[model samples]
Target: MSQGKRTSQGKRTSRGIRTSQGIRGGLLRRHRDFRLLWCGETAGKFGASVSGVAMPLVAVSTLHASTFEVGLLSAAAWAPWLIIGLPVGAWVDRLRRRPIMLTAAAVSLVLFAGVPVAARFDRLSIELLLAVALLTGTAAVFFQTAYSAYLPSILEPADQPEGNAKLHGSASAAQIAGLGSGGLIAQMAGAVNGMFAHASTFLVSLLCLAGIRHREPRAAMTGPRSSSLVGEVREGLRLIAHDRWLRTLTLFGAASNLALMGYQSIQVVFLVRTVGLAPGPVGALIAATGAGGVAGAFAARRVAVRIGTARATLLFELGLSVFALLIPLTVGGAGVLLFVVGGFCVSAGVVAGNIIKASFQQRYCPPELLGRLTASTAFLSYGTIPLGALLGGALGTALGIRTAMAITTAGIPLAALILFFSPIRRCRDLPTSRRPTPDSTRPPAPDGEPALPRP
Candidate 1:
């Protein structure tokens, strides 16, 4: 009888090990809906990365655009965050997120395809490029806002870290492929024709989105039909302002983006002109440096588990970013590795920090307010990007590209000071929910979900 019992226990233990191994293989292998979402999002990121390299190449090589004009082109791509970011968040919360994403993807497809068509007709101009970038930027704002809200609906809180890590990791890998191809495409064909590649990726994204099996239910209406959009926008802003964690993260994101974009806006010009690299080598170098994002994504969950999310954020965002100062030291031949090392560290830190923040926000924020919270924080953070681009242009023109790179890179580490000075410094793990007072009247979450805390 004792031997039989031992045999039975051993069989069960073996089965459990197999089950756990299957799960460890990841969501991409088992979860169909998330798999589709990941594929679509990764494709979209790949196209965007290609465009990032191709667009500037077209301006600099074909149009002979000056330093400031190149910066302005980068700025146009993000300016929509300042213009339409706030309202889009409220609108995303009020509608089905998937349709919004689909529509945005379609619009992007059309807009990107138009660029090549214009080039074929000998009608491509800097103004046309700027307009295309601006419109595409508008589409991106809607798609991104909806996508952030949609992910939480499909994923349980426990699975969110894995989901975020997978998505971010795959996106990083796609970016590497795209950036390298963008330069090669420009080198082999004309830079103007590269838009075809950008347009096609959106088609892949569109098809994947259309094939998603899980449908999101209609968003819950939180207020009267007559509620003003302005009021809703204000509510999002107030939530970020009042929540210490949200406030600190948002502020840090804004400051950090300002610095990040500042250097990125002029990096191509720096590499081509100051570093004297050809267009092909420039793209290859950028793509090589971006590999760090994959590493960061792979390690984020483990790092958070070992060191706590709050400490991981500090280490990733601040500690790794100190290498930014190496970029300006880059020159020809072996010296170019300096830029690669600096860029790799910065990319790793930023990607890891973003994964941590995404998981934190999805779990911490009230479900109904997630859209608004996403939008409000993005508005503040991404809004600085255009200004940063312009600053890079202005500084490059005034001081020099090398000097501008130095200044902007220094700010990457400095931005993390906000995190150190704020409530985050005292915490081990990020708070999962706000503690309600004794007399609180907030209702409990239905269906055995965690309780919704006060914002």
Candidate 2:
């Protein structure tokens, strides 16, 4: 193999950007292919951010959905990852990523476009809108799995954190910029045209992603195809489960997500009823969370590097656990202040977890397994959100909104507990790689066995 040849899709990196990959002992590098992939994802994710605002607005303002209906719209989009994650991951492993990713972008774009077309024809319905969201969410599962699997190929291990920072940073920044701008755009263009805006952004994302080029393995990542697809998916599930650290983290993440969904389900209600805030400040409060997220993404690297990603994750989670308790402490507009502080902490923890988890997964996994494993992790962890949201809504209805939220906040401490007990929290020494193979699909680390962290 060409020694230390860093290559990926058309990722343009500055010459001054250098770090040492443990494998090559070369200066840190970001390969061109990874950069292109990162850029494409960043751009598309921005579009999704727009959709986040535009979709709800369409449901609320145009369809005149009740609060419950609006919540349903959000839930529908998240439902698929829980439902389709594992199967889709296995499928993604069987295909070349470039084509699948492009197809996903195209399909998602058309789905968004349909909202405008239907409305222009006076045919827009809430059912049709929710269907569109569901399908796009499914597509997102595939595109994301492909992207994750494909990322490890272009850089040394050292560059993984930096490269991911760019990709994730773009996403965080987009949340801040896209949501506010989409709201403004929807105001001027009307809700239907606002839907069109998301489509346009997705189209631009498609163009950016299509520009990148890289060779992918012709066959599936697994050595031999299983006789059944379910069997294949099961293999992935078993792998993640058997990896003690991954399992712990996966549970923690799932718990955290459930709590977040529960909180979000009632956030507006709490803001309006408990905090005595109007709709405008409710929007501002939500938007402010993105600002904190952006800041966290920027700080992720230094925090992870100094404390080691796992410890940083634990520390961040602890902060979240503490801040989450303040949600029910609504006293004389104190709720808003508490929420802002909690939101910041939540954003920081989530971003920090992504940095740590992705790097950890990237180190141990082979290119082909990316789709299956990513899907497995997400499906297991993210699948609970809808249930959580539903439970929260019911609890709020029964116990009062504030009380229900107080119960939901309890998950943070559980997540913190999981992290505190796991070996991942203590494994601070970075893993090393001695080989120069640029294949994104890779063999196991720790000499062909799982890098199972000590408990």
Candidate 3:
């Protein structure tokens, strides 16, 4: 390799970079496996979001489900996470993960499709709807748990941030489409049509799962075959509990998610009832919030590279805390100028938090326990969102909507304080030059996965 040749090759690489950016789709070309998984999972997530709104909307508008039953519907999705997440993680460690993921996806499609069919026949009972939601969620937990375990297995260590950003981007885009399409279908197709729309989304997801061509490494270790499930679960817990840093990050993530949901729960209602926006504009305003999230997803890796992921997280969180605190005082404009700015800040904060957490978990946790770690962590992180929603709703009813909005702002400060006390806060931003090294005592990443440093 002469210097002239080396310089020529470097120039060509730079040209490739410019070409990819012009298209704004580098991850797909850069990492093929990740792209397939992301694309295949689309139907699953798209359908999930559609029914996420449709089922509850059905419960409320058609069945006149009380606040309690709607609460029940929401509860069904997360209950498994809290009750069975750790146990399930342990169980997953004992089995081949790919089959579990595929099966769960297939089952979820059927469960989601059934809701619409029952409704079209004019038999959408509250119990039936709730039952469908529960079963669908049950399948979703397995699908999701399996996927998280599957991630570190597939991605190169250097690729996880970009891979994760791709996943987040796809999910955000899917939800944007799902929610918007769901509303239109419900309006024009009647409530029954909404159910059909939900069903089609699920069917599409089923097809995507069929196209995924990758498999996990078979020799993948799973402790002794004779090990008890309970023992495995406890082992997973012990790993996190003993690690001062992991425990701190876990607690911080869980608390942040709860506060996020608390604010969201009250936001639209407060906008409609208190901010004086119509229902039509109110919903669009919420979608604007999603757009903020999409922007954040796009910005995640670049910002992490620039400021380092840790400091960027603090900057984003603190910025949002200030924004959340100001909500009560500032939401008076007729158009979306205020809400748009606030929503973008809040959503960007969430994207940064999630990206940091994902990168941290991938870097630190060994492959064998990844399942347990993710499930246990999700049990708290995802579980808290709904509780926050419930609490925020109650606060709005009791303290008046404006006051509830103001109080929920406390969650931002609370999350920052929690992080401040945690050791992870002191650690330099992840995705920096400190590359991940295999902790030989801990398990390897999936498939003899090699560890490499990200930029």
TM-score: model 3 vs. ground truth = 0.81
Over 1-455, each residue of candidate 1 has an lDDT whose tens digit, in order, gives: 00111111111111111112222346788788889999999999999999999999999999999999999999999999999999998898788888999999999999999998988899999999999999999999999999998897776555677899999999999999999989989889978778899999999999999999777655344444328888889888988886767888999999999999999999999999999998899989999889989999998878876676788888898889999989999989999999999999999999999999998888677777788889999999999999999999999999999999999999999998998876556555665554455432332232234543454
lDDT of 3 at 286: 58
Give all TM-scores, in the order shown.
0.91, 0.84, 0.81
Candidate number with greatest TM-score:
1
Q: Please report, in order, the local distance difference test score of every candidate based on alpha carbons.
A: 0.85, 0.69, 0.63
List candidate 1 stretches off by more than 4 Å. 1-25, 221-226, 436-455
Query: Weakest 10 consecutive residues, lDDT, candidate 1?
Result: 1-10
**Can you list the residue pairs that collide in candidate 3?**
43-205, 310-429
- Which is the better candidate, 1 or 3, if ranked by TM-score? 1
| Candidate closer to the true structure by TM-score (higher is better), 2 or 3 | 2
- The digit string of per-residue lDDT tens for model 3 on 103-210 reads 887677677667767776877798887677667677777888877777767665555667778787777777667666655555566544566666666566556555
Residue 243's lDDT in candidate 1: 72
Pick by lDDT: 2 or 3, better one:
2
What tens-digit string does per-residue lDDT give for candidate 2 at 222-309? Answer: 4666788898799788777666656777888888888887777666666656677644455556667767677677777777656656
lDDT (Cα, 0-100) at 308 in candidate 1: 68
